[model samples]
Target: MRQPGGDEDGTEPGDGEPGSRLAALGGLHLEEAPPDGGVPATGRSPRTARNRTLIVSALLAATLIACLGTAVHLFLRINEPSSAERPPPPPPPRPGASMSGPAGGGPRPVAQPVRTENDLDMVCADRFYPSAPRFRGSAPHPVMISEGEETGADFRSTRTLNRAAFAGSATQRRTWAPDPERAQIVACLDLTGPGRKIRDCRAGDGTLPLVEGRYRLAVYEVATRRRILQKDLTGTDRACPFVIRTGAGDTLHSAVKDQQLYDLLHQRVEG
Candidate 1:
């Protein structure tokens, strides 16, 4: 072979080029091989591996610490008392128990008794009638009568009398016949003892002599002692009279009727 520079052998300008197949074939070029066996790795090296090992070890230690902390917290919570299951205790009371001071106190004051209507009626009776024997006599004409139930509101004790009984005496004495006027008077004073006193004893007309004093009353009148029977006794003949006796033996009679007796009686009994 001939050389271009007039050398004895044929040789190129790049004689030491690396990875040259021509240089390996000894065609007058020198080539060099790489110092490393192959190409570099795409990722980490041994030092990186050591760093990774320490990083993994640190992460594992952190996980263990976190788990231990969680376990300790759960252990403490399980041992503690639960407010949901327990009930609150009741409050304590004082030693002595009472409404006024403390417990075991004294009694309080009570109210007084009030007077009723019944009490007032009994009082009226006792005040008016104190003597037992003061309402009885003869004509003054006295007729005996018995107690009867006070049915009417006005007149506690009353009965109708025959008008004809006073016909003979009517001409001589100014007398009222058995009418509303006479019945009215009996109604007023009989129960209260006003009817017992007859002052001016004309045959049929008269006034009662009621002195201011306490008197007692008997429930009965005795006409047997008078021996005064109804003579004509016909056509409502004879004196239609009412008689009442006191507890002390005095008797009351009235031929003239008054309304006051009945009114007072009515108020006391039914009302």
Candidate 2:
């Protein structure tokens, strides 16, 4: 059992002992010496600690710089508008030519009697009652009606009183003259119906003669001849044609140039 040399703890040392012998062979004293080329057993090497501290300090500096920049930007934004403030704009101008009366040297003009053509134009549309009798003229048969679309922009219905003429019961083709020229005789409408809305007229001239009498004319549709929308040419003519937009209660008075379309409307009304 006991062969070679007895070890320190009463066990034989093998050809290669585990710890102290190996250290000694490699030039290290177990209790005192360090391995070959190894650092001393003091604290830590100055260079390693310095490098780690430098890296941590660099990261911390970067974080502090980013925070400071963000704070500065927020502060500038908050102060810029208040420091460079601009005043509110002035109120808009008043509408009419003169705020005072024409006599006060504001907008001077002599008052004159309204002429015949002016009176005739005045007969076109009356704003007070949009679908009432707007034109009160010397014409024999006065026709009033309302027609036009109901706003927005879809297929909607419109209505108008084209013309109304009283020609003494005799059926005859008549020649009517408007201010500009001799326009063809279109359909005449009779506003004998229960409901009638008269609108204002936009007449350029206040002194135009409209023949005073009942008339018979043909109402022709410029668009389609479908019986459902065809007009009759045997009624009174408004001083002008008025267009009504659906939904919105706004009314539009047509110009004399638009009488042809009015003629069509007259047919629709009467028919």
Candidate 3:
């Protein structure tokens, strides 16, 4: 089955091509060149090419991300205000604002309260029973309750220096004004009217009377003339009004209650 001008494998020899002649002579096999204008062989493995492609793609992605971040940062900086907003300054104070106080911020003098026509000022000084009354055996200490005070003077619910009240029948146990010869303590509560007063009438002395009442509860020792205690009494309506409300007096007395003067003379017998 051999053709007349062909080899055993039916191949042509010396067909006017160098590759064909070399094949006809046998043994030498030359590699064919790739097609014209094709890519040249670099002899690199597929793994190497794949790795290079991955590196290039990563570089491109990084560059894109960096550019996007830069663009966002610039946009934020451009849209912001130049500086932060601030509050307006306060207005200046008016003239003579500090004239009520002392100059150069010294201690400001407290202004005394002005006495109005109807104002009742019955404030009195404070003193306490620092020492208990001493007793000799058991003779009742005689005390004189204040009487014939100024018309408008009275005692009410205790205030300021007051610690008790002098209610009506609940407190009037004994005589109002006892004789000074029989009494050992004179609970004298004198008064001076807010209105104008004249001199002494019985003897006709020309000296002016007091303006305001000295609202006090002064307990005096009869023979010794030593002051036991003097407390400021609370007044009613105007200063030191005798009658206001009815009860067991306004407050509790430290030493005596009920008939405060009588209770003081009778109960406070411990020395």
lDDT score at residue 216, model 1, on the 0-100 scale: 21
**Compared with the true structure, what per-residue lDDT tens digits does model 1 show for residues 1-271?**
6677543555554454565445455433332333584323443456789999999999999999999999999999999789977687776753221111112332222132212222112211221112211223322221112122221112123232333234346421221222221111111112223322324323235443432222122221111111112111001112323443323223223332323222323232222
For model 3, the superposed segments whose C-alpha errors exceed 4 Å read 1-139, 147-180, 192-214, 237-271
lDDT of 3 by residue, 1-271 (tens): 5678976777656766786787676433333335783433534556789999999999999999999999999999898666565455676854433211124533222233313211111111111121223323453453444432332333312211122223333233222322323344445454422433322222124222223223445555433334576665433322222332233232211122234444443343222
Candidate 1: lDDT of 159? Answer: 37
Clashes of each: 40, 48, 7
Best by lDDT: 3
Tell me the tens digit of each residue's lDDT in model 2 across 47-79: 889999999999999999999999999998887
Error of 3 at 135 (Å): 6.6
Model 3 C-alpha RMSD vs. true structure (Å) is: 24.2
Q: For each candidate, what TM-score against the reference?
A: 0.19, 0.24, 0.24
Q: Over all chains combined, what TM-score does candidate 1 have?
A: 0.19
Candidate 1 Cα deviation (angstroms), residue 209: 66
What is candidate 1's local distance difference test score?
0.30
Minimum summed lDDT over a 10-residue window in model 3 is located at 117-126
